[model samples]
Target: MGMPASPAHDTVDPGEGLMKKQIRTTLILTLDDATMSSFVPLLQKGVQVKAQLGRSMKHLLCEQYGVNPEYLTERIQTIFLDGKVVDNVETTTVKGGAIIALSAAMPGLAGATLRTGGLLAAFRDGLTHEEDLEAVDSHELGMVTVKLFNLLVRELGPVLLEKGVWVTREDAESLVKRWADTPLRAIDHVEMDGLKVSLEELAGLDWSGDSEYLLLRAVG
Candidate 1:
């Protein structure tokens, strides 16, 4: 006699397992208080970001990176591109190896002067970033160095970390060591050269002094 038909849910789809694995691999990291503290310093200094070339700063942040456009326009009062304050993010192109720093509204006259389109913008005219009209070779892949300061570091840092940032091996090692002392444990996995590494092994390595960047992502 033929066996009774199996339940619909009992049938396994071969593609379903692969899809689940992909989803898990690309899951965003969750940043709790302790995790934020451990990574704030690194975020403030700067982290390498991979983005498309030939996009404006506004486009890169709001569209490419999924940052809220309203937040960019309202909350992010200060923006620096390549060490100079940027007044027009729309016109400012994001080239390879560029540095973009963001900060919330600052206090005092200095803050007022540094802010884009502020009344005191004239005071810092020399320091304002001007868009380069010269043509540049565009590529499918581009890298930008992004720095977050003050409240932005706490607010947007986690998102960038989840998206993935290029960090130095030495810096990564230092971060792991610092966390070793903390009571909170947040690192889900650590990989170097595409191989997963244990926390103990990562902390023990003597990383090269030269600039060696690694894509670091924190998942909890």
Candidate 2:
């Protein structure tokens, strides 16, 4: 008689591979308490579509939910499985898979913490506006700024200076001058050296101390 099938063997499902292959994304949503209630289901759907997740999110939140994508995206950080490990790379992302963490960072206290953390360099680059800042919480917002600044300084700081992104004290001064006008949104480029500026712009953006940091999405 054939040997008894192992318990692990019988329980193994073919879909397990497919499920593992499935894009795992973690979304860090930054919204008011009222808005989070609406996002839960939408987030469930986002993980379903995988590649179309971002598009789906944009449609539901931006179009249907009547929320600003930038405002929401800024507060969210998706951590997914990737390769290797490095101290500088606090966040990991894998293609087709994303893990999300949500938090609110409006301004005030968070901004102060961010400035103290040295993330203010980017905001010293440009300015955005007031209404934009009101949408997020301080602590949540500050962490993103810190991450972005660290990434830029680590990866692109040399190149930006080499390419004249900024060199002289005049450039820094000019950016500081512009800060009085508004708060700027920082951009994180995954493929292009990971230089992010939005965090800095939003550094002085909000002053509200209500928010949380989504540290880890999911680990497999």
Best by lDDT: 1
Candidate 2: what lDDT? Answer: 0.24
Which 10-residue window in model 2 sums to the lowest lDDT?
138-147
Model 1 lowest lDDT segment of ten: 19-28
Please, what are the lDDT tens digits per residue for candidate 2 over residues 1-220? 0111112111222322322231122111121223223223223222211122222323422443234555434532221112111111112212233332222333564443333113442453332111222222211101111111222222222221111111122222233234334343221111101111222332232222222211111100
Per-prediction count of colliding residue pairs? 0, 37
Clashing pairs in 1: none
